[model samples]
Target: MELTERQKRIIQIVKENEPISADNIAKHLYLSKPTLRTDLTILTMTGILDARPKVGYFFAGQNFEPLLFEDLYEKSISEIMVPPVVIKKEATINDAVTMLFMHDVGTLYVTENQVLLGIISRKDLLRSTISNTSINKVPVAMIMTRMPNVVTLQEDERILDAGYKIIQHQIDSLPVISKDNPALVIGKVSKTVVLKHFIDEAMHLKK
Candidate 1:
């Protein structure tokens, strides 16, 4: 709930003139009465102000963290990324499946010595099994979607970008890579990470 400058000023005005009417507050600030509607509602709901229908508005004896909902998606990917789960590129598709289930992650990176070779998901492994080729005999290298095609994020990219790319690519997870060496997989961010932000924001009520 990032309070606009006008909203903050409105709070200050209300604090100075307790039980002030909305029309007068707007007049004092030279703003249209209707323009203050949403601002007042937000301030009131967030516990920063109080109101009674006929009595007008008053300070709620509470303060809100003005930046609570500000630019959340603009946060950097490194801040939201979870540890990457990896398997050897040479490992069998069966091995990749085991690692996928073991970690309970939607996607896994195919790597050797921390360098990201490719990415594998349950869908990728599933598609392999349905093919004429024997999934158990197929190597992860053959089934995994290799880089140059894999959608990835850098450490400093915004988490919002992660969300956008996730929806754009229709993938479950994104690998966070180093800005200097794109091959180096540093971390990962999933839909769960983006969702956790919304959940925390909602649960983080109470001034």
Candidate 2:
């Protein structure tokens, strides 16, 4: 449901003057009523404007947002990212496993203080357990994908760019870092989260 410039202007006009007739609306736009007939009909059909026999039209207050392609995918990372599940670099492998399950996340951001050090995934923990390592004593630092090697996203990057990076790197999640300091982890964006955003937006548009 993308709205044309004229359609948008029509909505604004109706909002300012409720129960305004097509003639007045056309007057506001300085156009003939016949020229605005299709726009008015489409607006009413989409529930954006209400029509009446005697009362010209009123803003319907429904579907106010325009669902353009850019509006859907050009949102910044800060708009959709979730808090990163963080664990200290010195935390034991067992502790990492606990954090992952506790948060129900696919990846955990490893940090020292507030600075991101690395990231550990479920596969890392599984491999450690299979190797007969002492999960309780072994530090997560031993297995985490270290910084400078880990792929990260900036907080201000577009969602479209985020999706592309995720697929290109074949990673499940990206640690969103601060633009001021690359080592500072601010949030996280995952494959699941991105998919959910698109799905939710699509469902909203259908409504």
Off by over 4 Å in 1: 1-66, 69-71
Best by lDDT: 2
lDDT of each: 0.82, 0.85
Best by TM-score: 2
Instruction: For candidate 2, write residues 50-98 as lDDT tens digits.
Output: 8999878998888755544455567899999999999988899999998
lDDT of 1 by residue, 106-135 (tens): 998998999999999888887887773666
Quote each prediction's TM-score: 0.65, 0.67
Q: Count the backbone clashes (under 3 Å) in each candidate.
A: 1, 0
In candidate 1, position 59 carries an lDDT of: 96
Clashing pairs in 2: none
Worst 10 residues of 2 by lDDT: 64-73
Q: Candidate 2: global Cα-lDDT?
A: 0.85
lDDT of 1 at 173: 93
